[model samples]
Target chain A: MVENTTHSEPSGDDIRPPKASIGVIGWLRANLFDGWLNSVLTLVTLFVLWKTIPPFFRWAFVDSLWFTDGAVCRDAPGACWSAVTTNLRFIIFGFFPYELQWRPLLAMLILFFLLFYSRDRTHWNKYLAYGWVIGLFLMGLFMKGGLFGLTPVDSTQWGGLPLTLLLSVFGLTAAYPLGVILALGRQSSMPAVKYLCIIYIELIRGVPLISLLFMGSIIFPLFLPEGITINSILRAQVAIILFTAAYIAEVVRGGLQGMSQGQYEAADSLGLNYVLTMRLVILPQALKIVIPPTVSILISAFKDTSLVVIIALFDLLKTSQTVLSNPEWMGFSREVYLFVAILYFLGCFSMSNYSRRLERELDRGY
Target chain B: MTIADAEKVPFYLNPKVRAVFFQIGVLCMVGLLAWYLVSNTLTNLERQNIASGFGFIQKEAAFEIGESLISYGSADTYGRALFVGVLNTLKVSLIGIIATVILGTIVGVARLSSNWLVSRLSKIYIEVMQDVPVLLQLFFWYAIFYESLPSPRQALNPVAGVFLCNRGVAVAIPEAHPAHAYILSTLVIAIVAVFFLRRWAKTRQEQTGKYFPVFRVGLGLILGLPTLAWVAFGSPTAMDVPVLQGFNFTGGMTLSPEFIALLLGLVLYTAAFVAEVVRAGIQSVSKGQQEAAMAIGLRPNLVLNLVILPQALRVIIPPLTSQMLNLTKNSSLAVAIGYPDFVSVANTTMNQTGQSIEGVALIMLVYLMFSLSTSAFMNWYNKRARLVER
Candidate 1:
């Protein structure tokens, strides 16, 4: 049974290390190049790189169909940059009114800048306050435009990236507080409210968000008074808001439930009310526990903005679809879809990576 | 002293009084909001002349699902259509869950392999799969796997002339004979017997460190007994291999592109999540546990079986349960791929009948039931597999 078996666990102060290398490099040599399976996989991956990477580089850069205007794409023999150029506005705007496109574009840029600037350590908390006040004021001034001698853009005209960003930011900002309250309410000792929150959370969490969105699309109108009608964008936002709140509640509730009851007792002993206890002690821990899931939910919501297309709201994917329907570039479906996929991938991938890092950071204690 | 203790809570500091005041305020705000919304809905519905209620569920559907498990067509009632949708959703979830678990476990174990390539490949799979939006993955797989398939005339017969094409795949299937029913019955009986026997063996093992060869026995009982009956039943089912027909193949079994795409996407997307769960589960078992088993003179395999795996399963099963729930929920993406899952069918029913309220309610109820059952099943499993904490 022991005939010439050479495998053994290397010792800790492995004197000469079984040759020139036995740790990382030896392990790699023994694993990757040792067998046909590994070799084949290696070859396959290399082959894939060779095949896809070159063309990717070429089309994206080297021989790219860039900057020759919309008409030059036909002769370019690579990815049609012309399609992106011509359709870029629609792709980002969805259906926002053409006249006030600058407002949304500005707002989106400001939000992006705010997110980046907020992450900078040099600027204290006051910067965010300034950004918020000025940013919102400017956005409102631009969007409403009645007092600025700017052409007023209707909400219906909001189409692409701006709409998607606004919806997501609004949904997230609204959902977080609502979600926390609901999570707290669900975990509360109250007989009526706890049951109510539980029912709401479970019912919402059980279904696909698309179903909720569909319900909202259909249900929002039903909830409106006879004479007054809400805009479709607002209707969509309501669906997203409720759905986001429910999901965020679950995430927050996870954090809440994970907290040892000792923390609550300790807070209670300190004579702190529920609000003060939560704000000071409970929320910080729960927020840490649920950070990764919260980010993922945000990412998911970002991705989910595409689903609004199903309800006839022209988010990015819808904008892409609109591009495809163009009579001039009718058959260029692949290019358009790829562009949309790339944009989505960028957002989703970054958040997923960030979540992984956050999870690691959070899990250090565990 | 009790009276003094009761009076410790000042009027301003009375907790019950505070709760009441806060709740009343909350209730007032909620009531006003609800009142506004309800009045608005009433006006809207009345103005639109839209009659609400679920009477529309009984109306004839006059529509068809591309893929139907149960007997269904355009002639079916709306209720029947909804049932078909529910069945489709169940089918996708069940199949997707099973496939994802197997694939995920395989990939997860591979990631721990001494083989660097295997681990790297698994990592790549997880990243690529998780990075792309599921809808995009669905479309990608649908386009690549199904839409790009050769025409029926050029069908690729990978196994026994099973032709795969844009329409679907056609394969050989057995035609059931009369005696086949007895064979199936015998199989069921054998499986039940095996289950009971396994439970008995487990108890016996626990009672006296003498382990029964339950795996071998159960396998033999389940497979052997049914196979014996199959011969005795005179081979009722006949093999029916798909034949090349005019533009398409005449089938034994068929899988539409929509079903294929939905299953592929669900499996691919979910397997990444499951791999992470499996990895975490394995990692959760501390090295000391394995080393302790080894120090006690057990072999590596025995160490894993006796100590590491048992403890790991405790950690694994909980999150694994949620992954299953996620897989089940993700099956709703079937609608996007045009595979008439429950949601899609419900949507169609809603649209045709204009009974949005009823349709939405039913969708929620069905999903609730699905999620509830899944959670219940997980709880039961968790209890059964619970660590024997002293």
Candidate 2:
């Protein structure tokens, strides 16, 4: 039908569109007020916005008690942001000795700086790898502190932003290589290897991260020799790695399947060995094609780090809960939770936007 | 030159030989690690004097579960308590999946609305929901439901015979009698008969090129059959209207605050992902296809139902299945709010019996089964959807 329309030669009347349907007003008419149903939808949406937005604005900002005491906040008819400011320290660095709190703060800054540095794909090199290693080592040193004449803090003391970053950053980095291996194993000609990979991926993907963390914190201890303790934080980290790797493996396998078989045949015809063929011909394209899904997996892995709270490790979310649990600041949970929500939103939203942009840029050649 | 060209490569350099050797090496290493762990666990259990295995599941569970679908007491065995927990988990997850899909599909269609405000609102919702961590959302809703509601004595009666309080939302439900069994069985039989009727109708339509009112007929079979059975059985179910008696409401179905909050959190969070899936699925049906359908004089609704939806569903079902699986697994987060879900109950059992291994294993097994069943159903749907081609 469209072919028939296109095949017919256009006359003068067909070439010139109607004048009332060409500008911004015309767009509004066509899209928003195109018909009776659309007009009603527009009015209903406007009514909903009018009913909700103004009150939210007034409560969140106009009447909000941002810099005040608990008593003052209680008297106020709006949000009590004082809950956030008053307990900011506890929320950001839960249970780290009060005087040495600067260490975690420093560690978090380093992580953010490293993350900012790595966002530029043009700077991808061995230097970036070295920088991450150095930065992560520094962060660990600052948190754990067995060297540089600093007093040692136990792993139990590690909490808040540093723990969240450590879990997500390390978890994703470790998971990616492991995921690639598993993806390869799943595609291998060796039946045992293929089945092993398939089973591992499926089993891990089957359960929730909470169950995995529970296994790490409670059940894994049973497997260890008596009195040989692994810290709860590390165990949870391992669980996150295992869980995330399974998902990432599937995403990577999708990329692998997308590659043309001709590329493999060409490499084989060139007398390239299996390792050389995969490393030179397959992996680079496969990994590039998978960047968007990989980033999504990373983003969700970052969010799943919050589940460590179930194991009683005080990551950012748990710390916020602790802040609310204080009787004096109990009624201001709305302010505290929203504040934490913003932090997560910033991380997730930015990664997703990056993925979209990267997808667009990669699509250019196609 | 011929001698050098004909020379054979060493066995160590052969790729196939190396691959087999690597596999054997890995297997042995894994086997050794497993052996070491098992041995360590056996000795550790011996030292702690905590005998291991599934024997403890039969022991009496002294801990109280806050909510249950079946009649449960502290006197029940650990196995029964866990079963109650499983039922609770399934209850919330089933409700969450259904609610999320409906909400997601609406928002997804709204995102494509010609009304600019509707699409923008939907976009904002998806962005906010996609970004926030779900556990935090759960906590946010839980906090609101737990603290912000009025006390039981002054509970908000938003509608007739319904009460909402910090405790929970209570509404009227039907009280079942002995004759309800007969009614239920009759309804089930009617539903099976309707399923066959629809199949026969479709086959007839295909063979004869005649339209049948299959949907309306099926609906009548479902509703009329159930109503007739109820009447025939002397109205076996009676309304159990809730009444404010003393400090709290009595009678009717009570949705616990924990269950409601968890339901809202899981549904809202998973809906965001499902919305994106739906949007993608709908958008995947090309504009050309819609235009072609319209050119054939098909109405807009018919174009959607007959042409667009079948194609959109092909794209939608795979991701939809994953989202469903995710919602089910995420019901475990009910533990954070003391929802007494499978994970929470198993955790309690583990703490009481010191059988952490078995408890964790059971949780994993249950989740695996849920995942497998969902995937199995999806696979069947995929096959059916594919059959629509040609």
Candidate 3:
């Protein structure tokens, strides 16, 4: 097929594209200035950034007063970062014995370690579950500290970041199995159990979390016999668990419904009992399908732990408020709030990012 | 032999028998717990001498609410105060839902923009707003409103008849007149007419391959009819401009600081979630659909209206409804900012009357009613939006 035609192949250098269509300039043209409207939009955004960024930077960093006393901060023209830096301990650990603050810190470190370890799906097994159980017990022991010759700090003393993590983490851990059970009940053929589960789920979901918290605080006390009292923190914890379980049940129910009828029929053909079928076939797939949504629910529950502040518990948000209420730190609310918000943002952002990654990974498997 | 074997099965081992037994056990346990709790509650109430019924709702509230829709005094009954709270809650939720939809749509579209900076900025907005705890955001906004704003004497008047101060934002509104009522009625009529016109146009388009400019006509009818009514009744020009009197602005309508802070926080927070829902909805529509519409010589806007939105809306509505319900529920956070919402008012009632049971029950009942009604309406709308299949 070598016809005698006067043709020559292009060299690599000749094949190279023009500079205007490949590098940073190319990106700018294609993404930021693809059309007249895009170019205008790019310019307007830049203008807005120019207007906002400099002032914010100057206030937050340049003119900010850090490592200073309240008297000095009051006179400063910008943000008072000292409010956060000086009271950082109180803000992070709250009213836990000041000398024993390391206990709570250690507890949080363990919690974080457990969370980080569990992030890898390959490590998710019976040992990980055992690890969580042991870790939770250690955390409680450290926070309470009656055993191991440690000072006996009451549950009432628990507050700040540790308290926030404890409520959400403990609440979610206890809630997941209950939520699954509720979902199974809702899907059961027995009308009584199904209706009961439906009522419980809808009742919890219909009202706001605050209402349930109110019942916990105000009505639950009256429901107890005289001289038998429960701590407000425990009450709030119960409320959060009950509230979150309902939401998780709904998400798990979606997963259950999404399972094909063929899967169930196959289990039946294998002569598996209902429990065995659910345990070996249904729940494994359903729970995996619902991991992303369950994570979302957990993240929201984490955020909602702040609502305990309304009930007068000293979570991170409440600690910040307590600090702000002091006469010495009266005017540094913006700084204190910004710091707390960053803490919350980090927790939420990481969880959501992990969920997205997990979603993609799960998608690849199928 | 099969029937005889089934009858020979042990009652405890039979699946149906076990199911019945389990249900009865659950019912018994639940009933026992309820009985125990009620007995304890009664004994405790008697010991504390706290009146248990809702009889306190008739008593004088004796506490002044910071804001109310209707004229309310400390002498007003608790029932009246509760009603006012419900109205305030509805007002905020309705306005917040509308604003959230508008802002969320804009942000969602911007996130999909071809412009890099625009999309990036919107992404940043969604991330930051979603990541922050909403209660914290509410506190932030409330701080800005209460701490940063100037006093009434030093109010910032950025426009002619608008005042911004620590007290609240006061904006001039048209003076009340009979013509205003007529104009409102005319607007309602125009809305009804447009509804019928849309149906007629849809049928006409289906029967005959023709298009109708229903939007333009509807807009014209709504606006023109209102204007005509105003003109026929001698168009009123007077406005109730705000004027500073004593320590506060008088005359113009003032949005309380609590209301503004609550509204702002709810809209900004909920809009982020709504934007994500909308983005997912739009993305769910395959690119081929748009290309196919464009291939048929439809204009870009026409492609969106005729092909894309109808499909995207099906995916958007269900999640959007939940977001709306979330906003409604989150409005209960108004208690944190002291916004005299239903929960806050009920909380006050509980504290005052010591009728915690009644107060808590009312709160649950009202919220349940709201949730049920909202879901019912949304379910209807979702059915309408669903794809029709043979």
Candidate 4:
């Protein structure tokens, strides 16, 4: 009887909907538990989450000490948030005059605002260049204030997020032009120029940044005339600039290699000289193609500024380490390091995301 | 095209003349700069009373290194101390590279998994790890390990014969025994045997149109032969399990906390980049490939092994090599945490002997050698990976 019923054609009104895997439950069944192995994996992942997350939440949030003194946190069973909050000012402006902390604060604001303004490629013109020049001058004036009646803060006293931004911004800005010139020189018809560029780039790229920083601190001073001392921070900044230029030269050369031969011929037919041809035609297109990789180099260079810690410069990372080294806040390195990591993540992530967006927007069909 | 037209050009305007003049200008400027710098450096060295030469490398290095691959002491020669540092750097880099490849490949493939949870978790891991500076991560990890772990007296014993404490982590290993040499010889033999067996299997399959399970057979030869040799030799090697002593664990192998932290920092940070490279390489292979292989009745594993990976390797190897080199260079960050790597050792030497130039030169020379050798190997691999056409 059941077989006969199945054999009969279904009436239109009695027709049933087909079962489909679409919603959350369906998705779980299809993705998480599609087979025995997947089911096992899903269970294992759940078990791991179960083991780690609850305790993490409890330690980080539920029982965490906030807005309290070190004395209160001494016996607390969870994280000491008060350590970071209490020493936040010291961490942000290491060794700078406590009263003049507002200067770095203002400088950071200017730097960030300028960075935000420069993100718009359509507005990239002479005005943008002028804006960077003015912004950097203002930042330097505010931080090193022997002018305008503000107390002068020595470069050695510069630290924390402001120092990080200063190093990365100035290092990248100064390095880009030098890198482009080196790349062009490497491609020159003259052997002397080409080999000079090659040796400079290769030799710099061969050594680690730490050694370069050491050279800047120790060996470089030896190279200078007697009693002609540079600011330690200035030395480190120059080291970063030279080190970054080498990597950027390699990347720019790659971009140059990507340019079609026809473009070169077109420039030649237009009667453009070498510099004119590269500036008016080659660089624009080549630079556009290399934006993603260039941004990557810039981001890594930004992070490499943290290596200034080894040279005893109190950059963001070094400042955090200084904060944790205090006996009162010694056990609170987790909170301090976490805060520093968040700051760096914000800088690096935004740059990378912007680069991806630029890559997508600039990709005009080959 | 005429002689008169060529002769009419001014010297300044001539491209050839300009090129030659520019080259001369560059050479002169470089020569002047070098002359000035070398003269100034010589003066400074004389003033500072710092002897500048490679001779200082042979002097006794009185500072202790926290970790070294080979036996090293404060009494070791500066050259030997530097070599120990190099070995330490290589140890971290080699192990880090291996761990990174495996972790990167897994996370990379998981990024493309149909499982929503798996892919999202992988994506989150890559993004978070990549965004943070590695030095900061190293400090964080070192601090966490120190804070979370109990003192040596109350060290956490998660497994038998393994201890974890603020000092470090100690894991058990098989103690060297009399038959160890025989066991190693057997391993070499197994490897050679597998190579020949694979060749024979390939030839036989080509002739008879039958497939042999070469992988399973090869695994058996490599693993089984060594085990068999060990058993026949009366199990000469035994586990050298670590045990908690008064102040520290004594026994098998102990990794210093600094080393652990640096290794974690380098491997985790670089794996994120490696994962991206892997994902890009796999994506560069067209989607039609898997379908084509499947239509030909190849199993899923065979489809991946024979069709997908070989093509993907061409895309992956270049970026992967660069990431490896990056990781190698990054091991220098060991200085930040005082891990006694090459840079750290060199820094000490410079400070002690006041030989900054030679010390820095030694660091640069070693790293340059590493970078050149790595790139040379990659170039060779790239050539082998190139497509062959009739």
On lDDT, the candidate that comes out on top is 3
Question: Which portions of model 3 miss their true places by more than 4 Å?
Answer: A1-9, B1-7
Best by TM-score: 3
**Chain A TM-score of each model, in the order shown?**
0.83, 0.91, 0.96, 0.93
Question: Number of clashing pairs, model 1?
Answer: 20
User: Ten-residue segment with the worst summed lDDT in candidate 3 chain B?
Assistant: B379-388
After the best TM-score superposition of candidate 4, give how far the Cα of residue B136 lies from its true spot, in angstroms. 0.7
Instruction: Report DockQ per prediction, comma-separated.
Output: 0.43, 0.68, 0.83, 0.67
Q: Write the per-residue lDDT of candidate 2 for residues B1-390, one digit (tens) a residue.
A: 586664577889877898899889878887899999999988988888988789988999999999999999999999999999999999999889999999999999999887887898999999999999899999999998876899888889888778899989999877867667777787898889988988998799889988788778888888888788778878754679887788777899888899998999999999999999999999999999999999999889879888999999999999999999999999999999889999999999989999888899999999999999988998899888885546
For candidate 2, the docking band is medium
DockQ-best of 1 and 2:
2
lDDT of 3 by residue, A259-303 (tens): 999999999999999999999999999999999999999999999
Residue B104's lDDT in candidate 2: 98
Clashing pairs in 4: none
**Residue A322 in candidate 4, Cα distance off native in Å:** 1.2
lDDT string, candidate 4, A1-366, tens digits? 999999988777775534456677677888899888778878888899899999989988999998998888989888888888898898888888889999989998998898898788888999888988998999999999999898987787888888888899899999999999999989887999999999899888877898899989888888898989898989999999999999999999999999999999999999998889999999999888899999999999999999999899999888888877888888888889888888888888999999998988888646
Model 3 CA lDDT for position B359 = 95
Q: Which prediction has more favorable DockQ, 3 or 4? A: 3
Residue runs of model 1 more than 4 Å from their true location after superposition: A1-27, A34-86, A95-103, A120-126, A136-147, A258-271, A326-334, A356-366, B1-12, B24-40, B145-147, B207-209, B233-238, B243-247, B299-301
Cα error of candidate 1 at position A347, Å: 1.3
Ranking by DockQ: 3, 2, 4, 1
Report the lDDT tens digits of candidate 1 across residue range B166-201: 778787878756766777888899889988998998
